[model samples]
Target: MAISLSAARLAVKSPLIAQPDPSHTVWSRLEPLATSDDVSDSLQARIADPLWMLARQWQFNELQGEDAGSPISAALAVVGLPVSTLLHQQNAVDAVTLPAGAAAIEALVEHEQVLSVHPKLNAQAGQQLMRRLRAAGLPDAGQVLRAQFPAALPAPDDAVADNAGFVWHMLLDQRAIDAQALASTLKALPDRAALEAFTSGLGVAAAQVGSAADLLSHWLGWLDELALDGSAPGASPYWQPQRLEYSFALGAQGDGPPVRLQADEYADGRLDWHSFTLGAAANLPGGPSEAFDVPPKDAPPPRPPLPTTARYPGMPADRYWEFEDGRVNFGMLGAAKSDLTRLAVLEYALVFSNDWFTLPLTLPTNALYRVSQFDVRDNFGITLTIPPAGWNMFEMSLQPGAPVARLDNALYLCPALNTLEGPPLEHVLLVRDEMANLVWGIEKRVQGASGEAIDRKFESTRLSTNQTLRPSADAPANGALLQYTLQTPVAANWVPFLPVRKEGATPANWAIQLQRGVVTHYYQVTASRLADPVNLRYSAFIERLRSNRFVETTGVQGAVDNQLQGFMFHPRGSLLRLDPNAPVASDFLRVEEEEVPRDGIELKRRFNYARDAQGRALLWIGRSKTTGRGEGASGLKFDVVTRGKV
Candidate 1:
């Protein structure tokens, strides 16, 4: 066993260095070139490596792509995800390496977000809650003493108090009280001086403290009046508990009449409305241990809209490196007023060059599908094109889905929607700077290699930074967007591109289709929650992972480990293979193709992006029993099924 294990250990390294593709004899050359014998020895070493076994079993083949050694590219290729996800995927992993102090700062920010957004803090609800809490803290302990053991009670009757101590059991025709609720209500109200003419305090409440027997008697009487709550302490019989939720009193008053004390320390405890402890604990939520230090009651909290709703700029129709926001933001199109009915779908590019001034893409004929190399000091960006057209590139869209893009990764929108075809125009690249240090650094990295040189040609052109910030406002044309910055360049002779969208302007579409209408197909869509749910998958709880991994993913680890986790080792995802018709949208932007079939005619539609109240795009999926409507004799009725995931 020891000898066999030794051989296996050495074999493990072989596949890592193997010619993953068996057909490539040149790539498989393992022996030294100086002698045939040495060559044979190298080949033997290759055969001994364990990895070589896997390479052979899987027939690993290397294809043209981002470096195989790169974490992003390797992960993307494995799951058939998009390259745009690389930056984010990698960053998500790398961020965890931040110093502990920085991590703590991030945690603090997260806590602030929670505090600001938690729903319980609202004025409409918080005030009432606080009042109830205050009520629990109010009633003095002397009241219970007077009601149950009068010797401890205050008053002019010292003899009565002394006599009551001997007889701990008290008799009483007692009325009920919700000490916490009543005390809170009393404290919350404006000064008694502020109230209208109705002026009378609960005399019974003020009088109950006279003696211990009286206090105990009244407390017991109040307890008797409470209805039985058969639920687990803090639980309501009808309502499921919210996380960390508590109901101090339940079913304590919901039945036909009054009852008395049934106490257990472990049972969800209840406080007397007039109990000294209950009144004293009023005015706080979570009682004491869970109490939060809240801001003044009158102030309102501020909020930012979700990224999907914020005004964001859509991507250029070609491979380009125009700036987009450094942080999360939805896109805004800088639309211009013009009638483009006569024009076809056109893809415009805006490529960024390290040396060249800003250049715009010219739509020579078709979508300028490209793989342009743009620099971000020490970064890269590009768009991949699939051949023969009408093919899906993203194997997954959510987790392990399209690009498996990390939250802040770069994006490349390609296969843009267009009716015409041909290579796109190259964007005019530029180089300029703000601080002198960056300009000098770029100049230093400019050493000519691969015959690819960073050369600049400057002009005496005056450019306005706000050139694309605001566009003309009009119907349809209002779609023009604002340009965002990804990384602020010190200075650059940046290329200038037309940022406005015309009626016939082509767009980098989200989903694509070919040959319109209903057809059998296999597809996978992703579902994600827009907001964090306080339950399930949360790290704060342990019962989380025991759930069906088939349904939920615990809060994801940093992006690197996330990507490294790759889809292959992941718990199985939902799989569905059904032949369904391609969907149609109501916000008609472009029609790619249309076809009539035996069962129905499929329409490939691009909507203008009008959304419903819930922010959903309404897609119209039309169906027909008949086929072939030529020359518009009679059209078919519209069948609409909205397209969006919850």
Candidate 2:
């Protein structure tokens, strides 16, 4: 029956529809979500509405009420003064006024390189001068130079001549130039005119001669500038290189209490206001307070001079639509539960970026500045005055358990010393030997006579070859093959420190201190059996060579005497005390127990030189500390028997 129903099909036509006209549309409106169970569903539904952003802001508490006003302008008054005088030593034994710029400061902190006309350095300087003369058109400048300024040869036994020699020998051929003859024919050319006349007689042009004279004068001027007498009382009045401590005054009249600074505090190159500690108040006979109507004892301490006022610069502006740096992507930052610093940074960037503002204050380098007054005027016509209450971000931190009051809001613009440090000239490692239960100061590198770093390990190896002792002739034949020794010889560079109790400590609270100790190397020699075996004891068979023992002293001695040049020690705990006023200098270098750790630490001393913004050359010797390679073994053992040769 279904097949029979398949008859001829008839085609039916469908009507065509046209698109709606543009002007015929009614007003459009977004349909609200049926269910707002999820906050995100409501946000997504009304995202196209203008009031959606406002609603989100309200949800996040962005409309909270606050009584704060935006700062429009700020004015700051500051008082600044350069350091005027320096007092050296704890006893205030010497006082000297500071020189202009950084010249005198460099002389105080840096060791004098020219001990006494070092021949090598003098020759080097002379060679540089000769090159300049040659460039100015004088081919025989070296001979003319020697003839003009004859070398002053001191007597053979004179101490000053110990390291000095004829400098021309380095530049000129010894065979061609007679040093003695040149010294004998010394012409007295005191002035420039005399020098020109003398050079003209040697067939040199007058113009060349003039240029040579100028060059010589300039060379001499350079030498004068570089020749600093570090030991001079006026130059380094308060510098104590041995202890790395100094005391100085900062007022124009130098009437304030001396400010004492210890360079060994952090052993870093930079020095700031935190380095200073106010010394005992001064007791001047006729101080400024005495000039007042009130009695000297009853009058208040002198107040600093009025400060100079100026507008604050580089203040931040608060604006909601302000463009921010896109590179700092806070969304991508990963933080762990314990990373409080990261979380604080993220919160400051996202929630409080516009709430905080920064105002920059600039001060001259090497000056101490105190903010006298700070006033801020807000957009709402409210003026706020901020007092200096040691609440600044750059305020000096107070030491724990210190008796001194918190430092005032004084900022010290440390000397503009962008020092270019040379490689460490001296390196010392302070390490602990757990097996021996001793602390050792290993002098890895020391300054040689020529101001070069000498590796102590290599030097000890070279010296040990000559110190070997042959087996004694009277010893048994078997002794030559196998030797029994009481102890092995320690490395000469490994200086020992013995643990000692504090002088005034109680039995229960005694603190251990490390005192410098000496190591003695003994030699044993066997003599023939005593002629009378019955009368002589065992001591007669073996004679201990006590007089031949070499005593190695503690502390590394440098090329300079009295001055602790290129000395560095890692101090982790209380710094090692170096009291120049003590009865004995060696006794005061006692280090605290915590200063020397089992892991060990390395300290280095290097020369640093820099030019400040004022184009003043600054030079200083600074110390640096770094973590050392784990532990060290000094190879020192007591009462040991060795089968091999000693």
Candidate 3:
């Protein structure tokens, strides 16, 4: 059922103050409009200049949005948009003076514009802003923001205007950019190979960023430094010979690998040969590996409908199972699709393989079970990868003048496309959070079939014996449901909230948790009675104990150099004090004694063992105190006690 979680909703507290968010895109989207034309024409008129107008318009139309005039109005509206406020914040400077501190605020405002050009300025200005902010008594605001993010940027000094647009458009960051100018610089270079060669050996250097926002921010700063404005944009400003070129590749193990690149001799803003990697180098012989086809995509006969009694579930609740109660309806996707103005790429991920246990397919606590995504063309891409038995799917529409949230986020959008009249083309799209618009989409030969991609399910984890759960055939429509009950017996090893600790080599003389009740909880679904297997978990916590905080805090003898100062200690190699909070073995002890305990007790002949007046045991017993349910569980006496006098 659709329950509105009160915790997720945002309540507007102020217009000027920033709101907390999981996604920081709203801030960057609204920034241009925040102090520009539509919302604050006064501010726009105040900073009005040919260069500013040209740059802003180019950015609006090319880099990110269709901001009828400005993105402000939409960014501040609270109704449908995620924004919590609309009114602007008070100006920083309020008044201006000659000192660098006085101009710092204004400088920040201008820096915001050209920040994409010079990233180093951001840190510099940040320092200046910190000083001025302290002077202004706004240290609280000076603290790093939780929702702060990168901005967009145009390409660096390159000479291919169209390519510049492509570069900025496909950015993974959101910062200011002047791609037209950078692209122009690259275009002026002789050819592509030369262009690639010039950038081959190059890597992001000091004061520069690789993300879109950093790129653009630094670009703007460079403009200020060079006394150039991109209102007059260009393509191919740099040119070079073909010998120097480069490409990017994932390393040998398919993880992050160093890039292979080169650069040309030609150097100048006009044109330079810079060889560079453009996109993922498909290790496949000719191109990217073609995605394997499945049978469900074609018009295959549908399987018998699952019984109406079947329940659909998510983590703890069965969403579809409560359909009669109007909790969740699969119809929401189609309804949402009808309402959306434009459609961005939708993604689906079905975890086919996972690492959970020595045994396979029982379900793993460490693995994720849900796979889904949705984008408002610009907002977020909609995708879903639920259990293999998912009940519904969401579709999207592409349109003209779509009122989509100008989502061109930190994506690498390339050769933007529009909806077509026929069946969608066969393509495999690879998108990453880092590269939005520039997805590695492989236009493929449409395979006429599709199939269930999810092979494994997330298994239930029993943290406590008091909790019980079960799996249902008719539950959790989209995801799986895990239901729990109270009073479930827990595993001896299970304990909630505490990090598991293992015993160290020199065992601390401690008591043993020999037994409990007859029944116990399991590491995996003790709640699900079926298919229980042998060795579902390790034997009853028969493990040596690690040093616990209690011992660390209370141990008084283990101290050395101020460590373990607060507690008592049982030293092995030396007389050491124990500090509970410090990670053990990470640092040395605060203080230590020259002589250490050299011998330990042999419990076999001892019942109440200890050193006597002469430091020797006078009497001893073999049996330990055992009573009640634990006694029966361990096959020992229950209720009664055994005593003997010497």
Candidate 4:
């Protein structure tokens, strides 16, 4: 216990030595030199020392890069030519100067009334005309007109006769009314001078108004002269019921030769540059009209290039701390092996998002352009000339076995059309019938005379009632008796297409064409002879033939005649002509056998309208094709008998 009393001091020392924190030294404050005198600039998080930044870049392996210099300035010399002429039906004989807008072409091809006048609008126009006549000092003008020319006024409830043409027909037709009686009844007109003034205002010859027909004609003409929202029917000369295809030529102002382009399938209201193909090109003095010259008067003066930045949806942010849009979450995408599209999208978003650069160039619409010279100056003061080559994006590809070569280095800015579409007015199902050894064009829906969509099935059902004969009373009393049918009748909407040998093909060739076929209906006749009391003979049924006998069986005709006589598809040309003729004399429609697959296809036509950049509204009818519900059974059979519960 006394060991604690010894005061023995012992110090334990090791080789390790401790030193003060170097950051606490006053000299350390001056270690990081501020190159900028401004306090805000010095406070920035960015490293001021270039060497340190370069070292960090090297650590990130950014130094081992494409070695290409960043572009500082670029000069692109382009030339554009406006479309000057249009050719219809692919015929040079039908060529004419191009219209001011593509809507005219659409309206003409689709048979859409460019100046569509509704019944209400027609009535409004008539009321406005009457109001103007009254304002011009005609006392009780509306009442007097109604009383004197009762036939000219359409009944308020007569929707069918509410059109402008109907009013003209009733008023201006000599057969519709007695000219002398109408003239005598029109004595309510104050004097001949007043009548002449009215005729002059209507842009009609005053001397032609001697008869009632002429006066009514003048009145109808005056009604049309009023300001209306739409153009008159047949106003566009480009419209042709038989010809839907159109082509055009783009040319500079007396510079280079014109380039001809064509659109064979403009049935779809959407008119874009992709709709056309290079039809022809003329050779220039140098070599060919490879590029056109922009009209000097129309071209803008040379100016500095406006800088453009590239961006895309669902792109990752450049900085780690930056916020990103949550609407499109690439991480949430669950891609499977079969989801190649998703994989490609992910690759584009994550890997190649920043690989694109944008070059801004303003070009006129409805024109063809070509880059004559494109030179880019990089940060290293190196100028690189990029010549027109085959590596063009969104370039029109040469159609398979096309007669014309690809038009290289061409850019077409077709008339910009952004359309809004209504529900399909017509729907046709093109299906293959393996059992019948034929393909069918089923008219699911067809446009009626009043422009309403009618269900073809319902119409066929309604018309086909009591068409087929019932079993005769002469049938045998045996319960097991059989009844024979020459051929089962198919629905009128199911058109038949027979496969025929392709034209000009060798015997070894496997090509065939699907030609329109006819379906004939035959009636059965039973005959009984006294020689055989228990047995009876039935005559072979004869086909009831109509006058001219050769009918084009496009099933839709049975529901509504001449409904399908318009734009259809063919192999040689994208569009086929369906001629309107009598059922007995109609021409057969032929299509390539390969166009119809085993699964089938669907075609639809819908009403569409669009507003152009200049705020002009264009209306048209467009067509679309989609995958159909597989093979269909038409229930057609030959020489079949049923022994059922009857």
Candidate 5:
């Protein structure tokens, strides 16, 4: 059994080592090496470490007074450990190496023995020790109390006779206070004067002059304002603007009692109102009524003289007039000479820049489309034609289903009307010409309260999204617009290119067709991975191998034993095939081999294929390397052969 086992072990040769591929190198299993060390020593010595107790007693005695016993004597009474144990374990506290060791030292100092053995030590001494421990990066016990109070409050242990000061600090900083202490403090203040004197005596700001009730009310009002303006503790700064939103039930309030209009005195006097329903229409009659006499076209009315009649003091009667030349005449008793004054006409031109300093009006085209109830009948035609000298890249105009009207040079209006009359109709204007690319921001140029022609200028060069544009006066051009920007729609997320009528549950599959410089591009992409199967294969063949054999039966220590005389064993041809069920559409191209470093050869092949019947082309890569390994046998008895494994 022993000889057979030996022969079997000898026959089990190590697998032949193949030359590695130069095109790729194996990577380390760990991206970064980790470090580890045992912390047993510090943890084991924690119970007997007397340095912590000694330090605690030393600090306690210092706070107590001079002439206190030595630190060792206090430590002996506190820890009661033997001198050898103390000396041996002192290093654990003196040189803390682990977080657990620090924790153990803290436990030793804060142990219950301190109060029993040295009951006279004030908490202040222990607090100072705690501060020292905190500085040393050790766990502390005062964190909970400190966190509850304002960070600006001096630690109570450090300050002398600061109870009242700490109380005031807590109240001012919105920190919690003991209810009993607070009540007593308030009760002691008989009046605001006394309270103020007490506060001043404590070096704190004076309380307002009033009774407790009045003082409380003032403080509460101030707190409320502070909260509203976001100035309270930990609140966002007051400079950040707060958004106020108001929603009214239009149908419910339309016919209700009229609301009184109140305006702030400091307001800019500019107000905007929007309505969701269609606006009121003029009640013009289609045909003439017979309530009055009608005159022939181009004919003068008959002239009638005024009738002089004497009427009773308390009664009045209606009388018909007799027409002679078909004219009625009336005269006033007094007439003054009227003079006509000739005024100079101020000729001012409004110029919008196409390239020069232009207005920041990027038409609020987005808002126009967002209107839920725009009267389609109110749609008007707007044409923006650059003068012959300007470049007309393209034209942008409102389309059907989106009502837009051009009022003047700077205002294009899209009114979202609410027939029931809740808010004023929202007017979304495309304030600039798209072809000109001149952005114009809304500016209100008002001259007091008089109704006058508005002269607005572009305030900015770029349009900000969701910005409210308020024009001072009516626009004067045929193409006035509020600037807007269009964002790229994410594929499979939004179908912005398609005409949206009703919002759907999920985004519809849509394509965008864009005409660019020479080619028109069509794009449609979905966020899904291809699920087609693919095939891969790798093959190599051993060309030759050499073998050696020895006849010695006695095994030599640390020496290789050979058998079957001298022989060359080589296996040829090997293949690894993977048929991944993927759609193959094209033949492989650019198949070639390159000589790599260390006499290595790499084969690379690329092919175009389709994953499905959609005919979309995809590229695949095939790469492999071939090389020789191991040294040839040196003895002549060793022979070389091929095509078999030994």
Candidate 6:
């Protein structure tokens, strides 16, 4: 969007000026028009030169809208006509200056030759006459403009002559021309050719501009600058080449490795090659040992009509499962499992794979309490590796699941059971924010063996629970093993907005989001329920607080620099300090409480306070406080928390 200077100035109460947009292509297109010498004298002479009579006739005929198939059009249509060549090759004649006084104007007015063709000058004609007179050294005109006009015109140097064709095209293509301004500027020059050239060049520049009014304004201002001894008009510095750099990886679906590529575009139009590597370089497993053929693309079959009744009696219509072709479809119904658990599993499968029934098919028994002759099999070790090449860079992103979003190879591991003796095999899927920082994760723990005591040796480093693993149809023949997946219960939807520059970072922290219109920011407060893994399982909590201690406390921390900032979109259309009209806070504390269990009995409260550092009014909450029943603080209680950045 174009920034409105008037609006901003009024809002900020400052004399704001509009800055030129660097993204425009005008400067690049006009670069070839630059010249080193003043060719106004030659151009002026060519306008009245006898040698150019034929060319002028041709141009005049074309402008008069003569017959399309006229002989003149045919003759002038040749690509390399001598008249056209000569027109470009013509050398500028000596310069001529306007005589000081009204004598020149009077002579033009009284000239019988001029009057025979035209009775009286119109407003535009009169204006042109005045400009010509002034340029030719009118006594009342300022010498400053006269001196500057010549310098601004294209010079008589080789550069100008060689690109004469381009100059001609520019002039002829101009839809509008400020005749008076051009005449005034050219008349100041001594050489008639240079004068004409200057006028034509102005026409070209004006045509390059968006509107005639703008062209006129810039032209007059340029002449004024020359009068003050300023340099000639040229492209602004904003048009200069800008260097840019980018890096990303093309990732594949279903446990596939990624291919990374990085490149830098220099200001000089040169590309600097950077690093490239395959995801397997990080020691990831390669494709499966068995040969495989990719399935040909096929249009999905039409959906079957819904059944009038549930597949089983007492079943809700929406909750019924139907098998068509090879796919089984089912919807959420409280009769089978909680809506939350069912939706979570279904959604997860939808994101990672097309088959949502894979896990549920392994359930111990169907809700119908009928045994079906179906066997559940695992896709473990079924190398679904993606090729490392043939992908576009644009497909890469800075979000978890994207190739460029993470460096952790663990995220690609498929669900599997290693040894029956060891604890249940667990796999985690994590998601990172735009900054490539891990924000959420989910843990799927596959049951190992029934009555098997989990190795508690690593209890401190893992989440533990007392709940027995639920058995599934795919459970090992030795015993009934349950497989379950859990993720954090936090409902975080934080988004980054503004970028924060950091030294030596591949991708600097960008996007400081405006969480609430009130500028309330949050960080590490609660893990996202959607993507984050269940880090502190309730079982883990029980194990840690098994001691007799009546109160227990736990806190999680990560990179201290990760933070959130709040801001208010001010009336001026810019970010303003939150509560700008309020008095400065000497010590202001803000508190927030969230109901997690959907029951008022369990709660999580967050407290944020003013942070003063390096003379900046920063807001920070390094630590968190949690108060709950028994194993922790009894009932509800306020906790003063102060710690490091999370």
- lDDT tens per residue, model 6, 208-258: 323333333444444332211101121111111111112222122122221
Name the candidate that leads on TM-score.
Answer: 4
Clashes of each: 112, 2, 161, 0, 50, 42
lDDT string, candidate 5, 1-646, tens digits:
3356365565434444233445755322213121322222321224335677555445434224433221110000000000011100112223212221111111111112111111112122234433543453432222432233222322221112224334434432323222222333545677766655543432222332223334433433432222111112111111100110111111001122211111111011111222122111122111111111121111111321122223322221121122223231111111122211211110000011111221111211101111111111111322222222222222122222222231011111221211121111111111221332221111222111111111211111111111222222443533423423232211110001111222232457342221100101111111111111110100000001011010011212321321111111110000000111111111111110111122322211111122212222222111122332322221221133324322
Leading candidate by lDDT: 4
What does each candidate score in C-alpha RMSD?
37.1, 18.0, 37.1, 16.1, 51.0, 43.4
lDDT of 1 by residue, 1-646 (tens): 3356355665556664543655534332222233321222322224546676656434322322434221111001100111111101112231222221121111111111111111111121223322332354424432332233221111111112123312211211111222332333434556434221111222223333233233333443442222121212211221111111112211111111111111111111112212111111112111211111121111111321111211224433222223554352212222222423311111122222212222232211101012223221112333233232222232111222222132112112221222221111111111112221111101111101111111211110111111111221332443324433332222112211111233443576433212111111111111121112422222212221123121123333344312211111111100010111111211111212121122222111111112222332222111111222222111111232333332
Candidate 4 lDDT over 349-410, as tens digits, reads 75567766777655555566666677878879898997776864666544444333565676
Where does model 3 exceed 4 Å of error?
1-114, 117-249, 254-327, 330-646
Q: Estimate each model's TM-score.
A: 0.14, 0.56, 0.13, 0.57, 0.14, 0.13
lDDT (C-alpha, whole model) for all candidates: 0.21, 0.49, 0.23, 0.50, 0.20, 0.24
Off by over 4 Å in 2: 1-74, 104-107, 114-122, 137-141, 144-213, 224-229, 232-266, 281-360, 376-385, 389-408, 448-450, 458-483, 499-601, 624-631, 642-646
TM-score of candidate 3 to 2 decimals: 0.13
On residues 1-646, what C-alpha lDDT tens digit does candidate 3 reach at each position? 5645346686557754443555543323222212321322322234468788667655434345544321111111010001011111122122122221111111111111222223333333344433443454444323321013233333321112123334433542233222333434445668545544433323322232223223334443443443222221111112110111111111111112211111222111111111111122222111111110111111111321111222233211222122243343222322133333311211110011111112111111111112122111212333222222332222112123322322111111111112112222121111111211111111111111010011101000111222323334554543324433333332222111111122332356432211101222222322233232332231121111112211123232332322222221121110011231244333233211111111210101011222322232211111111111110011212243334332
Off by over 4 Å in 5: 1-210, 226-271, 274-646
Candidate 1 lDDT trough over 10 residues, lowest sum: 568-577
Residue 638 CA displacement from its true place in model 2, Å = 1.6
What lDDT, from 0 to 1, does candidate 3 have? 0.23
